[model samples]
Target: MRTPIKRDDLESARSDLLATAVGWFKREQDVVGIFLGGSVAAGSADAYSDIDLRIVVQPEHHLHYVERRREIPTQWPGFLFNEWLPNTQHCVSHFQPFGKIDIFYYDAAKLTPSPWYRLQIRILHDPRGIVTDLVKRSEELPFLVGESDVDLSISKGLAAAHETYRRAKRGELFYAQTLLDELRHHVMQADDWLHDRTPETTVMAKFDNRASGEVLSSLAMSYCPCLDEAILAALSSLARAYRNQVLALHEKFQLSRPLRNDVAALDMVA
Candidate 1:
């Protein structure tokens, strides 16, 4: 479902979610702070959007506090619940049903703080101020890095090679359109990150900015044989660009996850 673009409606839903969360927390133990994070906090959300809420607790109670999450939305509207402890240095949990929620646990004496996080975050209620303070500390968190670098020249060279060896299959156009769409969205997100300073944008938005306004529109439509060479060229360019983009980040920040590694699949029409 497409989420609406209105800010007020989001805020209203936010207010409701916050109150519900706060009330739930009150029944458990010490709930130090509550905040807003993610797309809603960044002032961008769609009709099908979910909320991102962060619950902050005082020091010394980290483990005890996390244990209470399982029963959080028993009576509230929730579709998913996922908790993540990225590392031993800090404890963070994400809750999603109507939206997304992040709960940060902290010890005031153990750490200082930083300025911003990748995702937009705002303190809603911080009785002891630990939540806001922890937010500052988390900003200083260094990202992990990796070492493999996939050069664009290699990707481009491979693209040229593929054009010579592979026959134009029955689903070539379909495959081309899918790759074009993926490229468009990914590029748009890269632009949004650099342009708006917003950390997240839909994958589709990421590639939307890579090509000319017209070429993008055309790429989304059925592939015309006349443009086959051009489309292949673009895919090769993107694959190369992403290879380095992914590897460089992996080296610096250790950003490796289970993404499809099948470059050959890009050539497949299906």
Candidate 2:
């Protein structure tokens, strides 16, 4: 059996691993710049936080690093597995000793200005000052989502929740649960968008202390071993959370409230 990792040990391992990565990047001639992003850079890192590194290379050497991305992690200790995202610009590597690293490769010439570049970042190596220039350019860019976009997302969530109820009533338990999960995802995304934050898969992290605890409680009630109980409980909890979210949005942003009929439909299921 694998031993549980202590928090202090995990933090130390991450620190050491990051130092090793800095050394490796500095030695590579093709790597023009490197910056740290994500939780660590944001000063919110904990034992569970993974290392996020942005490697900026010359355009001519971009594909060279991409082709050999799999071998890159092997240079670090405790390499286990790596998965390349569909975007082909990032890879996630899991290590033995309780560490994961998210590596993003950006071609210096192709880099675009965005709000993400404005976020807290730590420059580890930048011989040509390319990453610094990118950060400065991104600071002037605006990132905004219209109220209509948030409204549409909530509407979609309601429709999906109704479909989930229908599936449950028809004894399609598996699909019903699946659709219910999707409904939760939509709600979480809407909430994040409403608050002018990025929609992340880590749902609880997006909410405040009280709301996060409530969401966790609702999730617990939604999952059950028995199909019928699971369906009923999941739909009921989803409807409650969905309604609360919509109401909050309407009150805060003066967005149109959900249709009465749709709210009634969800209410019926609960």
Candidate 3:
């Protein structure tokens, strides 16, 4: 039988792994800069936060690191396993006694300012001032959610709601449920935009803590059993809620609704 990794132990393990990883990268001549990103950098990290390590390699040496990204973390203490993320230069490593790290290798020359580092970042190592310069340059980057994005998400959500209702009526529970899930994301994005939160930020991060009571209340009605009647009821509730969100966005951002269709499929959704 395996013993559980308690909250305290997990916290300690995480810190230990981070220190070791950062120390290793600092010793590498090809590593021009290093910084911490994600929730940990934002000061919102909980017991399970993964170490989001940004490793800036000397351009010519970047490919060498990318080729062996997965293998690099094996030298860290308590090495268990690691997974390669879609981006070849990114690697997600998991450790035995329990810890996780997301490492993204960047060529020093290609680093640019972006909204990603807008929240918070900790410079672990910046021998040549590369990471420091990136942070300074990123300070002026703004987060933008245009009118077109809000309109599309709202319109697409309503269309999905209509399709979900039809599918549920036809007894196709699987696809209906899938569409319901997708519709949740659409509304979530719309809600983020309406609240002036960056849509590209973490999905539903501390939702109950940050989201308005109205959004919370409507979101409650969006989840239901897989049964046809229940699914249809949920879709109806979500359809109206999506429309209300669109109206709110219009009032907030002065964005025009791109598509207002027949209410025959989704009543009161204009």
lDDT of 1: 0.48
Ranking by lDDT: 3, 2, 1
Error of 1 at 123 (Å): 2.1
TM-score of 1: 0.47
By summed lDDT, the worst window of 10 consecutive residues in model 3 runs over 261-270
Give the alpha-carbon lDDT of every model: 0.48, 0.77, 0.80
The TM-score values for the models, in the order shown, are 0.47, 0.81, 0.83
Query: How many clashes show up per model?
Result: 42, 0, 0
After TM-score superposition, the amount by which residue 195's alpha carbon in candidate 2 deviates from its true location, in angstroms, is 4.7
Higher-TM-score candidate among 1 and 2? 2
Encode model 2's per-residue lDDT on 1-270: one tens digit a residue.
979889999899899889888889889999999999887887777798899999998999998888777789887888889988564877888886889998888898998888778778899898888888889989876766667877777778877788887887788888887888888777666556545565222222435442355565665566655386677777887789777767667666776655575567668766
Give me the candidate number with maximum TM-score.
Answer: 3
Give the per-residue lDDT digits (tens) of candidate 1, residues 1-270. Answer: 966456565556556666787677656465566776765567665544555665655567755655655445545653355555535332222333234444444443444554345346667777777766676667656532122222332233334334422422333655555545545444333333333333334322334454445434434442334355656555555545544333443344343432244244333322
lDDT per residue for candidate 3 within 25-106, as digits (tens), equals: 9899999889998788877888887889999999999999998898999998899998875557899999967789999999
RMSD to the true structure for each prediction, in A, is 8.9, 3.7, 3.3
Pick by lDDT: 1 or 3, better one: 3
Off by over 4 Å in 1: 1-15, 26-28, 75-112, 117-120, 134-270
In angstroms, the error of model 1 at 115 is: 3.7
RMSD of model 1, in Å?
8.9
